[model samples]
Target: MVQSDSKLHEVALQKLNDRGVELKEIAELVYDLQSPYLAELTMQPCLESVKAVIRKREVQNAILTGIELDVLTEEGKLSSPLQEIIEEDESLYGIDEILALSIVNVYGSIGFTNYGFLDKTKPKLIKRLDDHTHSNKTHTFLDDIVGAIAAAAASRLAHDNPGISKIMK
Candidate 1:
């Protein structure tokens, strides 16, 4: 990574930390999601995989954009009608997932499958973010975005380890 890329990643990581999202939380989610498929899995690889995925400019942009939207919704800064839609996290508001898919799409088709599973299962921080949406707090897009990051990282992990033959679909 270049100096500017490193700076961007640092800024993005700071933004995530500001929003109460931890790299370790994301790394743990990756491990939990991919552990079953690997005969020998460790948190170090999972953590590194998450770092690799987030290092991408595309993923950084997604994280910043999604988290900003959630912050806007939480602060009631968004304009009416749309604000209501996002604050409520309506079923029709799918842009969050759309932005998140940009991150998943980086890895390949397998990332899509992993994303689908994590989104459906809402494991770890995903479940926390989803539950937070019900309160005065808002995580309209963060949950889905984080899930995509984890899913993408898991896919990267599978791709890196040559011994793993059958990844669960």
Candidate 2:
């Protein structure tokens, strides 16, 4: 069954992959964040939840826009001052988090809390994406975008599965 929108999301996910972000990695991260709470958690369910979250057009759009900005920064294509800000990933520049909030808003409150944690902790690939000093490639917005995806996926899993609710009891 081929839905018209499926292609759009596939394209978006491909763009993320092209930029070195893997859905499986985000899925695993989601699994890690959520599994401790949802005792019955497994990779397959986590992957499904992650895919479901990505299926949203809004999520797809955010992913594409953020990754595109990162790529442009990497290529040094953006105009002077903007390029410098993006490359440096200045503290005052928060549009990255704002764009990412679009993804977080989809899954409700859990998304916000999870995003906050992941954004602060910068776990694994998230850390790698934010480390711009050593690598020529700049992540700037990519780190927040990646954290948003993982947070949303975790939120989705927590929402869709009743097991998590039970565990909360």
Candidate 3:
């Protein structure tokens, strides 16, 4: 592989691994989703599509959105009624998921489906990393925020690399 491709792969693997998603599991999921006939439809050549969405600027936006609410909680900035609801990660506060979906939407519907699956599955590593974030007494919102990014990255990989699915089988 070209050096840049290798680097991108490494960065992607590290991000997912750190967030608690196993490479093998991700590969298996990709394998399960693959169809030989659909190979031609892959977004592989656009490998950077997902990464572009998860770029630092985009992630920063998510962080700011989440942390702003968190800060409001800390400073008693929000009114009691609003505070209670915001603190609960309410259904209406689905901006996070929406932002996350933006990253996966690049590759098409398949990417969206993969992201949903991974997010719901909450595989062991993801849970552990999230727990660690909460216990660290730091920016707790980043736990889900980062997990979403990692999951999106994994989905990007699955969508871009047909080779990954072949390896899984």
- TM per candidate comes to 0.91, 0.90, 0.51
Quick one: ranking by TM-score, best first? 1, 2, 3
Poorest lDDT segment (10 consecutive residues) of candidate 1: 160-169
Summarize candidate 3's per-residue lDDT along 1-169 as a digit string, tens digits.
Answer: 5335445445645544543445444333343344342344344423343345444454545645655555566566789777665555565766557766655554466666656765676554345533433543222344455445545554555555656454544
| lDDT tens digits by residue: candidate 1, 71-164 | 8888889999989988888878899889999999998888999899888889888898888534677888888989999989999988877577
Better-scoring candidate (TM-score), 1 or 2: 1
| Candidate maximizing TM-score | 1
For residues 1-169, write the lDDT of model 2, one tens digit per residue.
Answer: 5436878798888888876887788887897789778887888887788788889999888887888898898898999899988889988989899999999999899999999999888898898888877788778878898899889989888878864565666
Worst 10 residues of 3 by lDDT: 131-140
lDDT of 3: 0.50
Q: Weakest 10 consecutive residues, lDDT, candidate 2?
A: 160-169
Per-model lDDT: 0.87, 0.85, 0.50
Scored by lDDT, the top model is: 1
Which ranges in model 2 have alpha carbons more than 4 Å from their true place?
Answer: 1-4, 163-169
Q: Give the TM-score of candidate 3.
A: 0.51
Q: Per-prediction count of colliding residue pairs?
A: 0, 0, 1
Angstrom error of the Cα, residue 146, model 3: value is: 2.3
Kindly report the root-mean-square deviation of model 2 from the true structure over all alpha carbons.
Answer: 2.9
What CA RMSD would you report for each candidate? Answer: 3.0, 2.9, 8.6
RMSD (CA, Å), candidate 1 to true, equals: 3.0
Clash number for candidate 1: 0
